[model samples]
Target: MRGADCASDHELVRAKIKISLKANYKSNKKHRKFNTNKLRDSSITNKYQQTLERHVGNLEQVGKSSIEGIWEIYKNAYMKAGKEILGCKEKADRPWITLDTKTKIKERRAIKTELIKTRNPIKRKEI
Candidate 1:
């Protein structure tokens, strides 16, 4: 395959890895233990478990690459979310600045102000 084709394949694999990581994260959060009820046979269970472990190890490597790719895609997502939640923007420019600081700050401030106004309403006394 050409270099471009190889790169595309790598990107596709990376995307799959990202999807798997997300699914595993959700599954781990939602369920304390993996559901192995389907594998009733001990041999099958052992095999399945081994496969899962190998897949998980591979996923970890992929996850690292995927995270790097994701950060490249939207390096400011965490920063933006933090700014929105914390009511403050980071002073330094993020490695990823697809959106300008001005825009991010403006949006974050607007959201923060809206949240505060909604959550902290003044009580009116009866006349």
Candidate 2:
């Protein structure tokens, strides 16, 4: 099947191919993502520092101040304090989209899709 339609005798040939993609299903649940942006907030940073201090104060009970021992205690205290102050957040597909905004966008997308598929100019400007 010579489907090539070359305007010139030396024209390059091109191939047309069709490909389909399957939708991926990845649940946003289970794993919790931390909000690093919260660190920029002075309130949160202060809270974390205060909490770290409190947690580390109890580290004396863990015993001797070996480098490894101190490091371990500090790390644990930092992580625990961070989690306690900031909490676990599940990052969203669109972080800016609120429930109401999402609904509106979905509705708008449906309208736009219908306008394109049906070639309805009125539907295009309905919003």
Candidate 3:
């Protein structure tokens, strides 16, 4: 190949590289769980039903063209009613294991490792 004269003596190397990258689409949306247990109360149930009905009453008047649009309206109404009436359930922060149990577990692990490393049977038994 003839090198271009206008530049330095080193020949220009041309190459094509195709790189394929995996798309990372992470959704940070957390689904809210409504407190359905509140519906067991008669007054709360009546309030929820009335709120839901009021939200959906005007749906026919809006006259949405597409099925998706109608569905979106219905979904929004239901979500709004539930959010107002039921609210989100609070998450409990209780620990699964007590701190005392955790410390004992660590001690057990340390003793097990010591037993594994000891060469003499007597030391292993002592461990």
Candidate 4:
């Protein structure tokens, strides 16, 4: 009787081990499918990114000449003002002027020129 009982307990343990192994295999298969789906989605997104980048490049090329013309106009204006106010002899290239500094200089010079012109008339009238 004791030996039969032992044999039944051994069979129960084997059955439980088999159940656990099947559960583990099912989980691994689900994980593999999820990873494959993520890889497919990432590849699709990369293709879209490449397509958008190509479109942007095409648009930039179409506008290139007009952008250059505008830059030249701004450059000439800056050089003219610099020569008038600061006694700068060299022509200013657009890339050479730091915009914020140039703007501050322009504002300061405008104020100074206006004040000088206004004060000069007052001094002449007094004389």
Candidate 5:
């Protein structure tokens, strides 16, 4: 077998094997990301605080509740308040490569293919 483009005394080895890979599936659940930028506004902040306080006050009457139960009340209150006041942020799917980047990548690939076609080392270097 032929080695790679790098300068090395090592020869490439070929192997034949059967390998099975499991297909990975993405989850259907949407991520809960609150619009924290809304919190910067004084009015929004005040509303969130008021809503959270009201929810917490209402849930605080669980008699002889465990520490975990109390923590759950606090968590649920905050989540509900944030969801009502701030709301979840929308997911923006932007392209991974820009137009300029794609053009540059095409230019590089063309140059590489030209270099590969050249038999002379000097011509490859010039390319």
Candidate 6:
């Protein structure tokens, strides 16, 4: 695996490209959960609907020449209004695990451990 031979005070060296296949592990992307329940609040819901109506009403052909342009205009206005009126909910990086669920998991693990240690039919049945 020899690189290019170069001799100079300031040398530019070239090396063979190493092609390798690596696992493309996806980052844990939490699904965005919009608080659509905000729509249940009368005031917020009304504001959102009004803002969206205004935005849509104001929308005109963006590119003027292409159908995609007009659609894009509508899409942008819709998204912008939704963002302004019903702002996206901030999500925690990790999903919340309730303390009750945590306690239940701990109990299950302890039971499994006890069943393994004793090899008792009763413990196995309990587990």
The C-alpha lDDT values of all candidates are 0.45, 0.73, 0.82, 0.47, 0.82, 0.68
Clashing pairs in 1: none
Q: Is candidate 2 or candidate 5 better by lDDT?
A: 5
Candidate 2's C-alpha runs over 4 A off are 1-33, 58-64, 93-127
Q: What tens digits encode model 1's per-residue C-alpha lDDT throughout 1-127?
A: 2223221223232233433344433344421233334457686566655654443444445466776664543434433433333333225665775568668767765654454456444421211
* Candidate 6 segments exceeding 4 Å error: 1-19, 22-33, 59-66, 92-127
Report the Cα lDDT for residue 65, model 1.
71
TM-score of 6: 0.42
Model 2 clashes, total count:
0
- Give the poorly placed runs of model 1, Cα more than 4 Å off: 1-38, 67-127
Model 5: residues >4 Å from true position, as ranges? 1-17, 21-30, 59-63, 120-122
Candidate 5, which ten residues in sequence have the lowest lDDT sum?
Answer: 2-11
Q: Which stretches of candidate 4 lie over 4 Å from their true place?
A: 1-94, 120-127
Q: Which runs of model 3 end up more than 4 angstroms from their true locations?
A: 1-23, 62-65, 110-119
Report clashes for each candidate as comma-separated counts: 0, 0, 0, 0, 0, 0
* TM-score of every prediction relative to native: 0.19, 0.41, 0.64, 0.19, 0.65, 0.42
lDDT tens digits, residue span 36-93, model 4: 2332466645654554444344444446658776566555554443333334233446
Instruction: List the lowest-lDDT window of 10 residues for candidate 3.
Output: 1-10
Residue 32, candidate 2: alpha-carbon lDDT: 58
Worst 10 residues of 1 by lDDT: 1-10
lDDT of 5 by residue, 1-127 (tens): 6535333446688999999999999999876999999999999899999998988885448556898988898888988998899999989999997999888877776776686579999888788
Pairs that collide in candidate 3 are none
RMSD to truth, every model: 27.0, 12.3, 17.2, 39.6, 4.9, 17.1
Predicted candidate 3 versus true structure: per-residue lDDT over 3-72, tens digit per residue: 3433243556787999999999999998899999999999999999999889887755658558787787
